[model samples]
Target: MPALLRIGRTLRRTLLQAIPTVLGIVILNFFLLQLAPGDAADVMAGEAGSATAESMAALRSRFGLDNPVLVQLGHYLNNLAHFSLGFSPRYGMPVADLIAQRLPGTLTLMAFALTIAILLGVILGSLMASFAGRIPDRLLSIFSLLFYSIPSFWIGLMLIVFFSVKLGWLPSGGAGTIGSRLTGLPAILDKARYMVLPATSLALFYVAIYARLTRASMLEVKNQDFVRTAYAKGLTPFGVTARHILRNALIPITTMAGMHIGGMLGGAVVVETVYSWPGLGRLAFEAVMGRDFTVLLGILLLSSLLVIIANAAVDIIHAWLDPRIGAR
Candidate 1:
């Protein structure tokens, strides 16, 4: 089959598979959230200091929290079918709108972090493999281990102190400068500056993992028959390493990176919280705190969908990198 045709088939199959997967996630998340202590109504009432029994009942009814568990689930699923993520009583807005407002920031942060992790990781890992037991390899190994051991939030804090407080080179928190009307390149640059710390903090741990994985993978691939053939063909060391060894080693690294995308989303919660970045992570945190089940459910559903899409894209990339995999 043609490559594009195979890719189309794979995407179709993956998306079809994702339907039941997303539905299951939605159902499970709804039920699991039900096990929590209070609903949105209860949280609202509590925050208001006091409410009469009759008023509390009305509040429950207003938000549809008065329904039976199964009934509530049906309503939620129905709303989802209509592409309505339900309404956030806590925020007095549609869940979809809230998510729309925040999704870009989260995506930008995730992209920045992932890019950093992959590029730095591959370069460092390549160097380490080249050096093996030399001083360069030893120093990088120590650096990777140290970053790997430190928590992301602590890293964010330290970065904030050193870069934002002491050096005054970056903003300490948030997605951008507050109340700034800057546009064009200035606006883009402002956001980039604010993003550097949180993105770096989130990327550091994964960088360590990727670096170690890449080093091991490259070393293993270097000993392969194909690598030996390439070397024997009189290819320069750099040419053999880059075109033969590194290319083959990338399969495992790509798979691992794809799997970690979802994990990075989870990690963003802590990083976002630490930096006060206004993204889906921060929104999810707020939803949890305020017992905004509707918003929380929306976030969870969307997050799962994003992960699914990411994995599907990875499959396509894998197929492209190794046509035999596509033939499968």
Candidate 2:
């Protein structure tokens, strides 16, 4: 009960700290976007091939782009306080609605990629540590380095060529087939099939990172006195490694994984672009090209919130894994 209380307190404290952090990100993203060369009005006018000075002025007025920066910021914050994300001139929809349509795709991709990275990485790292300096270790190290060095977009493109064009085993792009109207298990399976390439491409780089990190951490932990004692107590090598070495080494892995969530979000931009995945990353890309700052700002704010939430979840997991963390 006391442990639960400690975890609860930790969660509350983390959330409390996050409020200001999210606000700061919101303000910073707003100002940073203001520095960009054009606004939605400029893009709209360009798309129309030409516009008179009066038309441009009216467009700016409509978007509130004619307002001073400080006044615009104040208006944005006010709308945020009312739970509004403003409207996307490019998409012709509310920012919140646009994000709602895309958020699930991004979340699903991130979840699959993270799961693949962690599971494959931990297993490979454990094997490499066990074999330390053997042929297996060297081979795995070389492969990990290769994966780490490759750009995700290139990996994505290669997957498309091999799997989609040559083997014809899976989809080359998209989240799912259009107008299929699939339901239940079939729908889920269809989505998973489409998800495979992009998820794997996004995951490969992180898998390399976690694999190397886990191998190094486990090697260090294996030399600790407690690990030696566990071995002395006649525990099987697997048992000792799993219970003592890997468990202790997981602290660093967990920390890195938490930090990597934001990076993964950034990488999704490239992966989504390559695969034509209908996620926020692609939406953000479109917004940038269209100079739709409102939509872009909304995406940034939501992304910041997601990172904060992920970190909080990591903290809770840490507290559970090491009770001392909660006590602290």
Candidate 3:
């Protein structure tokens, strides 16, 4: 089959696979939130004071909490069908609107984090691979191991202390001062400065794994006949590796990186919460705590969609990078 035609077919298949995953996430999260102990109205009133039957009944009616679980779920599905996310009980706003408000901050944070992971991980991995079996390689290997095992929260605290307290360079904890918000280039840079520590800490885990993956893949690819053939033909080491080694080595790393992007974007709750960044993670955290089912379901569903879309992207990339893959 023609390469372009083959790629189209593969992409179609990939997107088709993603549909079921999206549905599954919606169904599962909705049910789990429903199954979670305590009724929604009760959760709302529990923190307020005593749960009078009349007041409780009123609260249930107010939120349509009187409906049977199945009916409520059916309504949810119907609302979802109409592309409506409904209002968040906690935020007293549409879940969709809340997501829109916070998504940019979350995206801004995750983009920097992804950038850090890719730059450092690829560079470190390439260096380690080039110097395989040497002191530099061993040291990097050990460092990657250590970085991978550390908890993000612990790393955040350490970064705050050593960088913020000891050196007095970065902020200790939080996104920024309330009134100091700026924009344009200077504002962006300043935000990045506040962002550097948490982004770095959040990225460390992915970087360690990706670096290891890259180093190993590159090292193995370097032994291939195509790479050696390029070298034997008097191509410069850099030229040969750039054209040959990295091309082949990037296949696995691309998959790993793409899949991780969704997690980093969606599952960044801990890092976001630790830094008090006003993003989806922190928002989702509050939603779950308050048993704001609408908000929680929306975030969970959005996260699941990200993961599915990410995987579809990875598959498309895989087919592009390695035409031999699923090329039948």
> Between the candidate structures 1 and 3, which one is better when assessed by lDDT?
1
lDDT of 2 by residue, 208-244 (tens): 9999999999999989999889999999999999888
Instruction: Sort all candidates by TM-score, best to worst.
Output: 2, 1, 3
What are the TM-scores, per candidate, against the unseen true structure?
A: 0.98, 0.98, 0.93
lDDT, candidate 1, residue 68? 97
lDDT of 1 by residue, 172-209 (tens): 99888889999999999999999999999999999999
> What shift in Å separates residue 102 of candidate 1 from its native position after superposition?
0.8
Determine the backbone clash count of candidate 2. Answer: 0
Off by over 4 Å in 1: none
Give residue 250's lDDT in candidate 1 (0 to 100).
89
Worst 10 residues of 2 by lDDT: 319-328
Clash pairs detected, candidate 2 = none
Winning model by lDDT: 2
Cα lDDT, all candidates? 0.93, 0.93, 0.83
